[model samples]
Target: MINKLNKSYWENRYVNNQIGWNIGYASTPLKTYIDQIKDKSLKILIPGAGNSYEAEYLWCHGFKNIYVLDLAHQPLDNFIIRLPNFPKNQLINADFFEYENSFDLIFEQTFFCALNPNLRTQYVDQMHQLLKPKGKLVGLFFNFELTEEGPPFGGSVFEYNSLFKHQFKMNVLEPSINSIKERQGKELFFIFEKKS
Candidate 1:
């Protein structure tokens, strides 16, 4: 399953326009979180960032050090067309595991669930590795039972805690009160600080 979710598979998703996960704008929970940030110079990364509207929102709001990474190239191309002024060097198209950089903050949108469940441990480890000490990983996760079938897989809060607790300090992991209508009951908002 992990092998099948490779670069070509995701590129094909874009090519065929089957990007059901593209919500077309920054998610409200993330935007609200970004609004409270007083420091505009922190380096942030959005992995698996397909047509990253959150990056667009951040850039517009004075967060200029944001980096958007995706395995598929098509979405990054689309993003450049939308935000022509965004620095091209910050737009990365590479395997997340192979990419190396420490970020002060990393935003997780649909990226986690879209990965094959088999790779969740590696995902956690890589996230820990890529975060600066005391750096944060924040954003949303789907609230539902995990099953065998899905690119949009699901998990409970309990499951998430078990997976991330060893390496991250969970500052907040709860049903998001401020989620958009379509995601109101289906999202878990989180802020996890990488352990020192």
Candidate 2:
């Protein structure tokens, strides 16, 4: 049976150091995307941001308004230790579903895959509600068959298209050419802009 996805489950993963989803540093695709962004003042958020290397990278690159939220505190604590200068107020330990705020951009990594499949529609809606008009939700999604047993649940282009088409203008949703070796061809790099 699939394990219950909750704060305890994620906290236990951190407690045991079983975070295989962590790639140790900011992902190359996201890093490159961030590099092209000229605006340092964008209001950014990373929900379900476990050991958020992306947020670290953004802050180090002069983006001051970045926020990181996770259900557990351990990973956020770890992040705080690594970046002592990162604003404490921006590091939130909260459930993503309960988080309420609008941002100019949101970055997705393993967070979406970590949720229960039944929450997919809610995920899309929450994303829509969180973004400012014409803002974007961008990142990688696993490209495989969805099954009953997974926290890293898989999905396909068709499934993504059907879920996001109404609320976002799908800009790109294709195989990630720069994914880490293990995820190459098994992930899609997407940019979905909230419909204005």
Clashing residue pairs found in predicted model 1: none
Pairs in steric clash, model 2: none
6-101: candidate 1 lDDT, tens digit per residue = 889999999999998888999999999999999999999999999999999999999999999999999999999999999999999999999999
lDDT (tens digit, per residue) of candidate 2 on 1-196: 3557888988999999999898999998999999999999999999999999999999999999999999999999999999999999999999898899999999999999989999999999999999999999999999999977787999999999999999999999999999999899899999999997
Give the TM-score (vs. native) of candidate 2. 0.98
Give model 1's TM-score versus the native structure: 0.97
How far off is model 1, as Cα RMSD? 1.0
Candidates' TM-scores? 0.97, 0.98
What is the Cα-based lDDT of residue 150 in candidate 1?
A: 88
Cα-based lDDT for every prediction: 0.95, 0.94
